[model samples]
Target: MAAGCFYVSCLALGSLGSICLLFTAYWMHAWRGGFAWDKTLHMFNWHPVLMVAGMVVLYGAASLVYRLPQSWVGPKMPWKVLHAALHLAAFILTVLGLFAVFQYHNQQKIANLYSLHSWLGITTVFLFACQWCLGFSVFLLPWASEWLRALLKPFHVFFGASILSLAMASVISGINEKLIFSLKNSTHQYSTLPSEAVFANCTGMLVVVFGLAVLYILLASPWKRPELGILTDRQPLLHDKE
Candidate 1:
C-alpha cells in the first residue's frame, strides 16, 4: 500500500510538472511572441521556458531518484550517477536561460538584477551550483571519507530542498513581473484580467502546486530511500506490509 501510494504521488508530480512546463512554453510562444536568441524581444521568451523546464521540473525529478522504490533494493551507485547527471543537465539549461534574459536586457539597455525575481534567480543558481559541487565531492568521489558523507548528508538534503523553494519563488515572481510589464500600458490591463494575464496566473499556480508536491514527496518518511543494506531480495521496505 505504501509503495502504491508512493507511485501515485510520483505520477501526480510528473503530471503537474509537465503541465507547468507546457503552460509556460505556450504562454511564452503563443502570447510572448515565441523564442529566439538573436537579441530581440523573442530572446526573452526562452528565459521562462528554460527555467521552468530545467530548474523546477528536471531538478524536482532528479531529487526524487533515490526515493524510487526500484532504487531501494539495488546498488546505489547508479542512482547517484543519474542524480548528478540530471543536476548537471539542469545547471546547463539554467545557465542558458540566464543568458537569454541577460542578453535581452543588455540589448534593450535595461539595468539587470534590479528586481526581486532577478535577485532570487541569481542567488538560487549560484547556491545550486555550489550545492552540486559539494555533493559531487562528498557523495560521489571515491576518496571521500565515510564520516564526511555522513556529516554532510543532512545539510545536503536541507539545502537541496531550500534551493528548490527559492526556484519556485523566483519563477512565480518572474511571472508576475512579466505580466505587469506587459500589461501596464495595454488595453487589456492586468487588473482587467486579460486572457494572457489569466493564463499566466494559472501557469504560476501550477508551478506553485508542483513545487509543493515535490516537497511533499521529498519529506514523506515512508517514501524515503531505505539505508544501504536495509533491503534485500527477500526483505521488504518500510511500510511494505501496509
Candidate 2:
C-alpha cells in the first residue's frame, strides 16, 4: 500500500508540474501578443526539460514498486543499475537542450540555437526510449546471463545520469533568462500585460512542489527489509499440521 501510494503521488506531482509549466509558457506567449501557432511551438522549446524530469520522477517511483521488499519480483542487479543510468542521462540532455533554447534572447540566436537544442533533445528522447524498452524487456522476461547484465548496467547508468543532470541545468538557464527579462523591463508597466516574472514564479513554485512530492515518496518507500538468512535464500518452509 505504501509503495502504491508513493508511485501515485510521484505521478500526480509530475503531471501537475508538466501542466503548470506548459500553461505558464502559453500564458507568457499570449501576453506578448496574439498567439501564433509557430511562436507557441517555439515557446515550448524548453518543454523537453519538464518532460524528462517528469518521466524521471515517474520511472523512479515505478522502480520502487518492483524493486522494493515484498514485491513479486525485483529487477536483477544488472538491470536495476541500467535503469538508473538511463533515467539520469535522459534528465541531463533534456536540461541542456532547455538551456540552449533559453539562452537566445534575440531572433537570430533563437534561430541558431533551436536546431542544436532540437537535435540534442531528440537524441536524448531516443536514448530514453531505448533504455526504457530494454528495461521493460529485462524485467518482464529475464533471459540474459548474470555476467552480461552486470556488464551493461554501468554504461547505461552513466549515460542516463549525464543526460538528466544537463537537462536540469538547462531548466535553470531558462529561469535565469526570465529573471533577466524581468529586471530589464521592471520600470515599464504595460496597461494589461502580466509580468514575465509572475509566470516564472508560478512555474518555479510548481516545480518545487513536485520535487518535494517526489523526494517524499523516495524517502518514504520501504527499500530495506529485516535480514532473515533462511528467508533470503530460495527455500520453502514447511508447516506442521497435525
Candidate 3:
C-alpha cells in the first residue's frame, strides 16, 4: 500500500509539474508580446519552456525511476534502459534550451553568461553531462565489475540528487534574472504584483513544488527497490504466499 501510494504520488506530481510548466510557457507566449529571439525576441521564451520540460519535468521523472514500484516500471534490464533513455532525452532538451538563450544573446549583441544564473546553469549542465556519461559507462556496460558497480551505486544516486539540487537553484536564479530584466522597462511595477509578475512568481513556485516532490520520492527509503541478486527481473520484495 505504501509503495502504491508513493507511485501514485510520483505520477500526480510529475503530471502537475509538466502541466504547470507548459501552461506558464503558454501564458507567456500567447498573452504577452509574443516570441522572437533573433530580431523578434521569441527565442527568450524557449529558454523557460525547454528548461522546465527538460530539466525540471523530465529529469525529475528520470530520477524517480529507481523509486518506482516493479508493477509500474517492470523488470530490471528494461527499467535501467528506460532510466538511461530518459536522462539522455533530458540532456538533449537541456542542451537545446541553453543554445536557444545563447543564440538570442548573440543575435542581440548582448554579452552572454553575464549573470550568476548563467554561470550556475552552465556548470550544472556540464556536470550533468559528465554524470550521465559516467553512469552509462560504469553501470550499463558490462565493462564495470560487480564490485565497482556496488562501490559506485550510492555515489551515483547521491550525486545525481546533488546535481539536481544545483540545477533547481540555477533554474530559480534564471527565472528571477529573466523576470527582473524583462520587467525593468515595464510601466507596471513588479513590486505591485502585476499580471505578468504574478504569473512569473507562480511559475517559479510550481517549479519548486516539482523539485521538492521529486527529491522527496527519491530519498524515501520505503520506495527503494529490492536488490536483484542473480535474477535480473525478480521482485524479491514481494513475499510468496504460503
The TM-scores of all predictions, comma-separated, are 0.95, 0.49, 0.89
TM-score of 1: 0.95
- lDDT of candidate 3 over 8-94, digit per residue (tens): 796799688877678668756864555665643687678778887887788988988776555344457777788999999999989
Off by over 4 Å in 2: 1-8, 11-15, 29-144, 154-162, 181-195, 212-242
**lDDT tens readout by residue for model 2, 1-242:** 44454445556765775665575556446544323224343544444334534444443444334233433334245545554565555456445545544553333344533544445545656666676666555533569776775687566555545444433334445454545544556664432334655666566556555545544543442432222322332211111111
At residue 72, give the lDDT of candidate 3.
42
The 10-residue segment with the lowest total lDDT in model 3 = 233-242
Quantify all predictions' global Cα lDDT against the true fold. Answer: 0.90, 0.48, 0.77
- lDDT of candidate 3 at residue 180, scale 0 to 100: 80
Candidate 1 whole-model C-alpha lDDT, 0 to 1: 0.90
Predicted candidate 3, C-alpha RMSD? 3.5
Of models 2 and 3, which has the larger TM-score?
3
Best by lDDT: 1
**Superposed Cα deviation of residue 114, candidate 1 (Å):** 0.8
Q: What is the lDDT of candidate 3?
A: 0.77
